[model samples]
Target chain A: MKAGHRHPADDDQDATTQLAGIATLARQLATAPPSVPDIASRARAWRRRQARKLAPAVVAAAAAAAVAVSAGVIPGSGGDSPAAVTAAPAPAPPMQTVRFLSSMASVAAAQSAPRPDVFWYERVADETGPATESWESTTQTGLLRAADPQQTSAIAPTAAVTYFAYEPLTFAQMRALPLDPAVLAARMRATLRASGRATGEHRTGSDQEMFESVRYMLGWGQATPELRAALYRMLATLPGVRVLGQGTDPHGRRGSVIVVALPLGGVRAMLVDPADGRLLAAGASPDDASPDDASPDDAASQAPAPAATPGGPGPWTPPADWTYRGPIHYNVIFEASGYVNAVGRRPE
Target chain B: MRTAEGFEPWYAAEFPRLVASLRIATGDAGLAEEAAAEACARAYAKWGRVRRMESPSGWVYVVALNEVRSALRRRRLERNHAGRLRAGHAPPPADPDDALWRAVRALPERMRLAVALRYVADLPEAEIATAMGVARGTVAATLHSARRQLARELAVLTIKETP
Candidate 1:
């Protein structure tokens, strides 16, 4: 993201020659049609036909990735494993080998053993800072409620927990997803714009000022539910990656969320409250911890909980040309745009 | 504030040219087109924020050109590090029609954008700097660096052809 190195002064002559060589090669390959109407039509067709075919596979692959996350994507609810945080716990019922297909089945079952309080019903609770207002219960209706409906396990409480495999409705999850890239871009743009200019002197304000970033980012919650549903569907189609058994983080939070493996891993992880559905704050996974450790916030002692978590906060825009693999929610897309260019090799 | 009425004509006129230059610079037509569109989209979305800047087109060029450089860099990285597990194959060797474009791709990401703007897209160094959100001296230095890189690449190719 930052510039590396460049030489000036006497280096000018050499720079020009280099620029010319590269530009010359580029000029020769410019065979695109000179017409605007044609290009637009082609782009439109690609989005409709090619994009449509590509979208579902991406969802499929991502769904597979999601399954991977059951051990890796979201942290294991039972946070004592030594492996990657994103790895999901195997769904081996108490003494039974009941293979789990989703974290909902596993986590739901784990939580099924009833607690005496209401906090257990609410997986995340907001204490303070950033996304506080957004804290609400998943048991309530609408996308605002739970992180994943498909992955949710059915809990039968009789002063004790009972987690029976109740795989959430995938179709219902898909139906409530977002798909249009352009619309997503627009909403993000608007939210970002509002954040920059929303202030009076642009310097500072009350507790409201602290929430500026949240206002711009999470404002999408206010958009039409239809769009939210579309996003839900899109996210569901992303790879299924759940963290394996959870463990204590370097910062020492009694437990840690898992990390998506390399190749498909996203940058940070969200830490939701086990008490309320609200997100507390978000910081980098332990792997992302910086070298300096000088910044108190960057270090574990005072790091804010990540307000955004997978299937909870906004989705990460997939890198271009990379096909969306698992559920859109998994963020495990791959860059398979242009590997092979023409004919192939002959047999030896 | 600038309506399509005010900008469309200029855009339609320059759009094809921009695409051609970006395609070469990025070594991928898709990347070029997307970069150009994303830059313009941002421009169109934030016309008010940029109208008063030194040169509006320059600003757009900076964004689009940078996009080209970034796209090229990303493509190269994916090709090199991703391995055969899932990546597509490397692109075919370049034809002359796209030689300069490939060369553009070969440039370091930032330098490539600066060169594309100063040479291929054909804008002044100052405006290029503004569009790129860098100091004027930075733009000048970047242009110089790109030219040097271009010459070396050309020289290498020329030497190989000698009898």
Candidate 2:
């Protein structure tokens, strides 16, 4: 019967028996002192990281401000959101939300386009302290200055001039982007997907990513007023966007905030100047209420260890401490932004 | 939570097998672990869905192999001969000239993966087919070819040893 088997049963068994030594080798190698990371735990860590990445854009702040904002450790937290002294607890009547977003959009649309020049200059100030003044050129020459003495000095030379790794789009390129919000959304989705950032099994480029892309353009890339208007229009179509009433930015700039609820109990709020439709600040508040067994007090106790802030690709950092109820806001107060002839030279 | 509980045992059982198979296939233990850990992490991230797939282990093997290939490609790009020792080149064999491991590493990439999945991972032909994304018969043939070559190489080594 064994000889009659079509599968070469005895031969296969002989092969398997012959390969037993290989199995022994494998088992021995497996037993060798593990030089690699624990996959199970590493997998869990990656999931946590992806979960944070999938969270909305509110956590996206400028890179320079990140260290200062987690300011409890670094003395003299410049431009950090002042611990709001809760004052007159008045019933802040229902804020007029629609008129707010649309009017902001109108002002944003009407703003004049920046004139063509060699460099784009911007000075951004935070609420409590620290500010970064950056000058960039389409030719890829760049300079950055910050309040920190180390950061503040003679305009230094940098290798690349493109705004935010995705080379800053020329004003013309910004205009050439898909004008239709739906088409624009698709284009942005394709860009995000191509970057491989949108790769978790359940990923589909959501409006949240669009929001970040737009913010990135606004922060690093040149965005014509028309492009800014289109971004707002695109954002208006996305689900889960809501007005959070009027709030003051860390820069003390008053703006109406629109919050987007993120996946797995997180929220991102963008503070837009209702007067000019300028995005003043962005912040994120994670769902402090997750983790079934932990009490709020337990969370607060776990909060201050200053978990590694993500300084990777995106400008965002998830809520490091589970205890915080408020968002960590990145306020951009543009003192001067225009075309400059050189990287070191501020625009006249 | 139920799914989490379900995956834990599955992970524990496969972790060592994956490490050993990848170690043999890539000829670098550290690279093997990194690749396996990365694939396993992706699996965990999508556990809610990955656990439902027909062969999750197969998926992991595929992802790990890709990782190794990419690392090798990157190492080639860097033109760092020293870096090659870290990722792809077989380490100094314990016996200095270990014939078996040298012969296994000498196999073509696909054949090496086939051999590792077959003997080290101890996977059946059907599952090996799933892991390698080939037909079941192809896996069988590949294993046969690998065995023949390995046997020939070992014979030559033995003859040389006898002399």
Candidate 3:
């Protein structure tokens, strides 16, 4: 080793001896090395699994890069370096984006959803906050249920209504939606168009509406495996869908993330387990605005009210008015999800 | 044809040494295995290109180290260090009382990776530089720093033992 400190070259001898000692100790640490055949098999399995998950996006990206080079949008080096060849290209076209999502949908559809005799329970272990235990009744009700009565009181306009009367799609309602991607996308567009916020005050456009709608549906936690796959396919068909490549969920399950660009420079990412149809986690962050432009502290102050003018509707607004307005920068780790015999019981 | 036939022999010769180096780097056998397995899998995926590289082992080492570091960072974020160390998967080394190994473990991740790769894997300075994604000069300096720290630690132990 080079003598990094200002010292005589003779001191290298003593350092070498000490390094030898460290080497001896490190050798003892490996008493039983993993077998080559074992590792080779495991490695092959991992590669196949990752290829199964990411092949669609990988192909689409390569194809897009090729097109970009041919069209003179990006200069091609034609070098032998794999890095040069596989460097992520610019965002793919809408059709390619839809195809990538369809691939994910196909993977999801192959997995089976859990069927519980009692309730749909989820255990969430927040990285930085208190752990939460939530269970939703399998049977859908006309009125939404609140975990905390005090929270309901806070949202209600008056004391006369003790519980919040908000409404979300029932499990039956979600299951009734068309499984076809194009049909689902059209239905979502119409839902956004007819909503009061779409044309009335907020003027939230179809893109932001679709983003919120997907998050809303998935967060319900009662949708069937097929419905969840349809949701992924629908989001894939939306504009500005970008694959964020392979990522690990908060629980350390490896998966790929796809993000949707939202209005007012926001982006929502969904971490889907490609092995199964499980939605591992979901998160959102505001647009990549500089701190000077749109700091988290200045969000509400900077956001103009969504009031309408006489001439036309106001500019498009963020999805802040939704019932589940996720934190500006938060990751919800889905630790456990399955049907259980009782609310407090975990699946066997 | 010979190169393709020789691949299994090459893998067998390299796997243990690589795992040992990573085990020292990560101080977790399970993590070492996981990272090494993933790297090997990736290498297998692109063997057409990887085998032609000047140092295929260096490529595998770089990928495996990255996986381990990311896993460590994520674990640190999710739980306390004590909680992680208590995990049943990473057993205490055989020489649990060895101060030299303790000092080695205490070294920063990069320095540990450099030391382990050089000493255990017996990688040349150029290969170590490639594996660590650093200049050969940087690898030399890191190893130097690690040795100086270990020397100081051993000297203290000697003085204490003499009394």
In order, the Cα lDDT scores of the candidates are 0.37, 0.55, 0.55
**Steric clash pairs (candidate 2):** A58-A283, A60-A316, A78-A129, A79-A127, A79-A128, A79-A129, A140-A161
Interface RMSD, in order shown: 16.1, 14.0, 13.6
The local distance difference test score of model 3 is 0.55
Question: TM-score (chain A) of candidate 2?
Answer: 0.53
Question: Per-residue lDDT tens digits of candidate 3, residues A102-200?
Answer: 887787777676665545665655444554554445543212122332332111011110100011244555567798877877776555444323212
Against the correct fold, how does model 1 do in TM-score? 0.35
How would the candidate models be sorted by lDDT, starting from the highest? 3, 2, 1
- Any runs in candidate 1 off by more than 4 Å, and if so which? A1-348, B42-54, B65-104
lDDT (tens digit, per residue) of candidate 1 on B92-152: 3344544444455666756766776776667787777766668999998777667677655
Where's the lowest-lDDT run of ten residues in candidate 2 chain B?
Answer: B73-82
Ranking by DockQ: 3, 2, 1
lDDT of 3 at B61: 84
lDDT by residue for model 2 over A1-348, one digit each (tens)? 222332544445544555667756666666432222454567677666545443333233233245334543445533233331111121111234434555666787899877777556666654324455555445532233323434443222333322211222444556678767668767766654443321222223444455545555554446777767767766665544556667776557787767654433555566777776776765555443332211111111221111123322222223322222355354334445677775566766
TM-score of chain B in each prediction: 0.63, 0.76, 0.78
Per-residue alpha-carbon lDDT of candidate 1 for residues A297-325, written as tens digits (9 for 90 to 100): 11211211111333321222233222212
> Which of 2 and 3 is the better model by lDDT?
3
Between candidates 1 and 2, name the one with more favorable TM-score: 2
All candidates: CA RMSD (Å): 23.3, 18.2, 20.7
Error of 3 at A150 (Å): 35
